[model samples]
Target: MAIFEKTPQTKAILDDTEKLVCTIANAQNINKHTEYILRVHRGVSKEDKWNVSHRYRDFAALHGALQAARRDLPLPPKKLLGNMHPSFIAERQIALQNYINEVLKHTILALSLNVRCFLDPSNYPANLTEQALQTVSIALRGEGRYELKGPLPEIGWRIRKHYFMVTDTESHANCLLCWQSYGPDRHLCDKDLQTAFKCLQNLSHPHIDQILAIHNLETGAYVVRKVHETGTLRDMIYGTEYSKSYLSKYGNPKTRKPLTDGQIAHYGLQLLQALKFLHDKGLPHGHIHPGNIAIENQKVLLLDIENTLLGVANVHRPYIREHRKTSSAEAIDVYSFGRTLYEMALAETLEEPYCDIFPCNMSNDLVSVLRLCLSSSSCKHGMPTIESLLRHPLFSRPLVMGNGVHSDGATSLRVPSQLKEEIKMAVAVMEARLKAEQKLVRGAKREVRIQEILGSEEEMRKQKRRAKKRESVWKSTSSLAETVRSQSVSTASSPTPPHHTSDAPACTNGSSSTSASSAPLASPVAAGGTQQTKVTNEAPATNGRSALLSAICSFDKTRLSRINSE
Candidate 1:
């Protein structure tokens, strides 16, 4: 007897969907109610744009509940006492923007059952929305998990509710990092994902922040990474480093404790090792600075290297790009590392364009290392290599270690304890002297303030031309340095060496002049090409023309006109 068996209906698999990005369009006050106008979209296209409005109080309540529910997540601090003040309101608005970023990051990290319910207001009981808006105690409900079939079942993370422990379904603990992903277009996102995964997968080091997983959704993918609690090295040096607007709202501390000489040495050695490894594998770190370094467990870790492949330019500051353009890819790493070393050694921030003389009162050995590293000319065969940095005297027990006696016909390189102690004391004295000098500089800050007031478009254009001329002078100096390096290399190869000062010609006051040695000149030969020609410092004819150019470069038309009228 054949019996007709009823088949069970199965739920359809959820398709991968595009990530939703929320940007604050405006915030307005209406009848004492603060309304946030947020624009949401999947990608750059305007087809699926959604503009949603919510009361400021709703965000405050959401923040409160999120704090209570997910202690693991770090949300921007909420302002309670002075919410109506203009300054406080402005600050809160920026914080709210940052809060949206954090929320989106968290949602992208793990889209579990609870996360879906938290995001979709429709899933909430009609009364729950009202309750959530009213009570700070009400937290979102649902667990975070992969909606589609995967290798593991229910391995996900989510914000906790009433119970501190996640329910029986959750298989993974709450993660510390809030991952962010973007898809300008579906095809582009896929292409970027594949490229990023391919590049990042081969990189594995103790100092590098490793990619744990790359989770793909229908329209985008999440690149999950781990971050330390100590935060970025930039945060350690400066009180905080964020967007300019964010910084203006919440003033960062002007100064922070600089890493000690011993600490810097330790960090440098490890980082140098990582650089050598990367370079050997034919991968340029692309970015290397204190800001990109992460400190965790008293160790130095590299962060944000994967962004280069994601189409996120490593152009943090304009000058960084300009400087990097002047050198090869691997050399950029060395050049940036040198700047980072200078900052760490001095325990202060550097104003760029590559200062030849540092403000810090450090040992000459330290200074020499910095000079070589800063010079773009040093990236060649004759310059100090990353491997050579491992054996630098600065990393030795003493800053200056004299020749040691031979041991079994070989020299003893080990430093004595007494010598090490003396070097430490010497560094400490120099640091104290620098701190005193810095105090004086800080005291005269108000007197040094000279704000330029540009009144007309013509004046603005003149100022721009002067700025361009100034940039041209610096570029000439870089070319001069490279030329000197090439000459030195060629001279070294010859049997008889001629007397040549390796002192790099400096561009001061927007004009370049060599002392005893002739510096190379970089003049515009074509729209994009610069012709390098040798120029002597003592040449009267060249000096006359240079002086004329300098006069034009330094002239402030508006100021001169006002002075003439007076």
Candidate 2:
């Protein structure tokens, strides 16, 4: 009986598998400064949570490191003053949260070593490269068959996986050495792992590259394979730049050199033959992609066939788990092969798995093969087997080698009866595990879809509320403008009253009389039917009063004199 127990490292791997959700939960004041406590939640469960405290300087350091790859980071600006204040700290905390969220949102930045270490130091240590090197060195020291060359840095996309160049001591031929964590899903015990490695070492086919050596370690395993200087098929189609980051490698398709129709037909047929051979021996190359294919002397050599036994997560696991139809181990391989073919045909990556419409320029026969593997109808019913694909019209003709050798004449692969039985059992176990994982993934996807719908509806509601508020504000402003406009119109249209001095005594007569000079002031108003009161005030004054006031006094004197004469 085999026994398996989930360790802390296994739990950590499981936690890492979940989508990361980071938030600055709160800010704490310590040592006369503020430190933000970031609550990192990996999954929906509250139990899968951890907190990391960081200062503004820490965020700045992360920003500086990432600025080269990502220019538009939302890092908060540094504050020279009042940074320690509560309000400033709070605002900075939110800004930092947004910055980290933005970083995590991008796949490239999130996978970068700097960002990973910053978010989870315990999981992604700064000396991760050194540690991997040391582990491989120790393993190689024990097995003196291969000489370890210097480390190959950032060569592949998998973060946990490390690569190193080595030379086979016996053959004196250079080979590639790779080490990756056993992962959380590995159920095989040490004994089974050893047996599996031995089976893989003995396994061989014309189109499949041979595994020189494989060793299972405590935390992970390392595999050695012959290194082709031409690099992977991806490098051949899309030019290689090993120095560039993994994300940048696929960033530019303009530099791609697409294969001709003949080349596709030839290599694709060989790939199918290799897959068929594996199936015949009761094995599945669970991992298949352009990155795992290499070509030398016009022969298509499939690499990384041992990944399945190593128990590392498949590159297309996310896509595979999403569709229930792709639950079987063979179906998964077919789906992956379809994707690889799509890339080869188009010289462009298929961003999504399902593609209904293909370019008109592509060959009809090629598209037909693709449809068999990738069409929704095919996925619903069943993807064609590798043997059937080998019989397809596109690959119906025999592939002739450069040296006048026909590929169809290659000898069939043979495996020991005991080894074959063991492989069959292993494949069964893998299929069962994959089906269980698919179930879990489907449920998780359904929940995610629900949350997205709710979030979208909430966002719509918020937008409507904001629009209503703006409409109300606009209406109030328009009404206030109209009131001011009407007041000005009423003030301009009305007639002005005759000028009077409150300090002057009341007229003796029943009606008060105005002086002649006051007539000029009223004349302009009477002619234009507009107020000139403001214009009259601008006129030069006599003594402390205007000319109109002096005229009023003169008229009053004249009126009194006239009364005396009467």
Candidate 3:
């Protein structure tokens, strides 16, 4: 009555799981126009790949064609206005991409579309067909030029849509039991499953249900997820027959509702953290209703991320309609989350004209946060960022694992003791590593400064040697000039008496006049020599002090820079 018996179908399902492969390789804008080129790869084989470009109008036309082709099928809503805006166009492109993704994900849609167009690209419009063929031709030419080729990589967890149920194993662990049903359309379930798979990846949290594995059968696909035993928040508030009745244990005496101020805070924190994680990754979980939320063991888990605008292939949903139709995807998620907080606080599903329901038993802090979330204004003013929401005073209270009011009189999230401890331990380890890194950086700076000092000392020594060589050359040149001046003065002053008596007197007079003029020149030469002597004596000391001071100043400045940087 519990676990399913191992059968031939089970093995076949597991084997086929390996064969199912689908990946989105690239989404390129075509010709700088409203169209986008999509590269879809199926399985690991080269033959399974195909490329196609689709514009916004093209997607609308495809939807219209599908509707005309089948009156029974439900199509997602189409944009009637604001298509010209860049942001709107980008979001619509993603929606179209997700729609195509969903089409390929389901067997019925895949077969229908395959017959309609995908089987042969030429079946599309002439321009689109030409574009596809040209893309193929370009790829073929590139492949031919390659001297070698090998098999391509496998696609991502090749998951198709399937129906699933939560069941407890003998080990007391909860497992998601999924199987394909050919009964009804079940496209909505497939939509949810694909939304979960495609939107969030490599994300983990106690409050988040993570995809564990996928099993594909000849008839349908199966998805397995890690979950808690306590069931979902919906099951807790209401009741479930699958496990020990949570209602009997945790429900209130009067209202029979287990969720109170403490429980709301706990769930709110976890849900906010999950939302923050998604928003940080640029993913908005368009669907945040109560049923999509699960409570595993004691932790509140956020389920179904794939229902984002693009995740559902544009399927119309009540939650999307309830929230204002805005171009801001993140804002839509925020408003939905606010609505969820309002419901959690009230312990009931919120209906139209949702008024402020702050009961006397509810804490004021919790009520305030809910008010901010439920505000009708724009996100910038009414809704704070996810980061700011996590910091609300409600979470400031000491968190106790598995419920009960905190010592600070505030009810806070206490999903698990182990998770909180792990986070604290991680923080401690990071802090220690950061300190060690800072110390290493300081030491490296010190080493660099010491090297600079040594380099500056060597430079100062070179300056001193050059200064000494210049001073010696100046002294030798001054000495040679002084000796030549003395010899010239002595030759000019001599008598030269034995010529003619008349010429001798004239020569003596000319010699006397020349000596007089030379005497005045000698005074300037003496003054120049005195100035040169003074400069020669003081220049070395002055130049050396200035050079040494400059070197020291530069070295100190470099050392200071290193210190400041460290």
Candidate 4:
């Protein structure tokens, strides 16, 4: 039996920890080169597994493109000699596998269009933009109300989401057309999704961008909204130089213009009012960022309000998952608003390890509001409500300039009774789904941390074992040296035998006794020679023991140094 049941309709949502895992399952020689068959899956599920084949050149090309972002990529060096040898090919395959694994480990590289297309060409085709344009064109033609002008290439961050410029025939007004896949995370079924879109089309508020038309399809949906010539709020702040590239737009926030205190207050208050209006109707935007907002004549308009119903993941999901208090829909909106505010204030994305400290130059009121929304205490307890944020002193101050003033005073949305209940039910279902997903994410993160701790502990135990082995070697060497020293000392302390036979030799006559006295002297000299020989032999043994001791000491020192360095 499998650990996980296979449900083709239910697609799994991958977290950061469960990144794309690839293995070179096999290799085959084609023409003059070797192509490796890679088995790829986001998680340990047979249903998610897919295979892709690529030659060495493909890997090299991928590395070349991504090298600028990550300089120290572990791409294996190309071999000229014996390149087609089976042994070499096998080794290179392993190296290439590791290189790709390293590449996918990085979130930026993993999410890159190049890498995605390389790994799964079937899904992320090279002509993905063209395919999106075609699908959108067909959908718009079927509706007969809008005419597709041209695609807005590389405009947004989402891979499956595409944007195009379109014109409404009846009004002849230029509008923005967005086509996005329902995706695996979509919370509503087809009927409910249609109802949700219908409800959104009728929504009217001073701060909300009105949806001109909505066409939900089997695979995805197409939405049309009036184009803002000023582009998104992000374009307003970042100068729109790299707006076509999602990475460049977000990766270089510091190089852009930050919102001033007055602008922040003006925009912040309107955003809060918009959120409050939605929350009052039991709806949440779910996606709130600079890019999802538009500025027209100094007034902020919240776009993509139907994204929550679309069941797409939130932009700040990774950050939101870390805080349990953000599980609720309203709280999630508040947290997202806080992040958006941080970016506007500092002209930089709020990085992890969120802090409460703010620049001294910032106003006290601004800092207080930031802390209330972003501080660790706020995450643990709960962020302020959108209504409360509207009442905040930072936003409550009277405007010197008449900014964000709109004639549309109507704050309520009216829909069919059935559609209203459907919208309410959809919002409730989406919120429950978001909360469940967040719980899973938190659990996964906790498990990862626990694994890291266990790995460190295991490494410590190995280090201790190595230290003990070195200590034992040192003890043994010291004992051997001591034994050798003791042997030398005993040999030196024993007294030499006295020449007692000399008295008998002296009593004998001169010539005959002289020969006998010489013989006794020879015996004593032989005894002293034997003692010298013993000492000489012991000296070499002592030298050998000293050498062994020195070698062991050197080895121990080297081992200790290596261990300390590690």
The prediction achieving the highest lDDT against the true structure is: 2
**Cα miss at 125, model 4 (Å)?**
3.5
lDDT of 2 by residue, 1-566 (tens): 14463322542244233456789999988998788899887644547679999888988899887765535788878889888888888788878888888888765566667777887888888887888899999999999999987888676767778889898889898888988876655555577667777877877677888888889888788989877787889888878754355655653434778888778888888788888878776668888889899888888889988777666677766556556678777898899899889888878777554767888988998899889888877766777888788778888754433442236544445556766665666667767866776677668778889999999999999999999999999999999999999999988986575655577545444434554334434544345422334444666554335544433333333222222535
Task: Report residue 500 deviation for candidate 2 (angstroms).
Answer: 39
Error of 2 at 273 (Å): 1.3
Q: What lDDT, from 0 to 1, does candidate 4 have?
A: 0.73
In model 2, the runs with Cα more than 4 Å from the true position are 1-18, 24-34, 43-47, 56-109, 241-254, 375-381, 397-422, 448-566
lDDT of 4 by residue, 1-566 (tens): 12353223432243322346788999998887788999888543346788899988898898877754534789899888999888988899889878988887655567767788887787667886887888887887789989888887566767778888888899999888888765544655666667678778988888899999997776678889887777788877777642265655553344588888888888888888888888777677878888899988777889998776666777676567567777778888888888888888887777662567889999888898889889999997878888888778888777623643534578767566665565676667666765676677667677889999999999999999999999999999999999999999988986654344332222322233333333333443344345444544567774654443232222211122122535
lDDT of 1 at 204: 64
Which window of 10 residues has the lowest lDDT sum in candidate 1? 155-164
Error of 1 at 66 (Å): 26
Between candidates 1 and 4, the one scoring higher on lDDT is 4
Best by TM-score: 4
Instruction: Between candidates 3 and 4, name the one with more favorable TM-score.
Output: 4
Error of 2 at 191 (Å): 2.6
Model 1 Cα lDDT, one tens digit per residue, 1-566: 01343211221112113345777887777787567787776422347566767676676566554442333444456556766677766776777778777766643232333333333444323342233222211221211331211111121121111011122224453322222222111112333335446556555667777655444333223443442445477667655532222122112245666767666777776677677766564444656877678877666678655433322223222233224233344455666777788778765545454657764667676677787776544533233667777678766654222222111221112223443343334334433432343344344343344332334666889999999999999999999999999999987875432233354233455432332122211112111121111222344774755643443333322332222535
Give the whole-model CA lDDT for all candidates, comma-separated. 0.48, 0.74, 0.46, 0.73
Per-model TM against the reference = 0.38, 0.70, 0.34, 0.74
Stretches of candidate 1 exceeding 4 Å from the true structure? 1-172, 176-203, 215-221, 239-251, 315-317, 375-385, 396-566
Tell me the alpha-carbon RMSD of every candidate: 33.5, 11.7, 25.6, 14.3
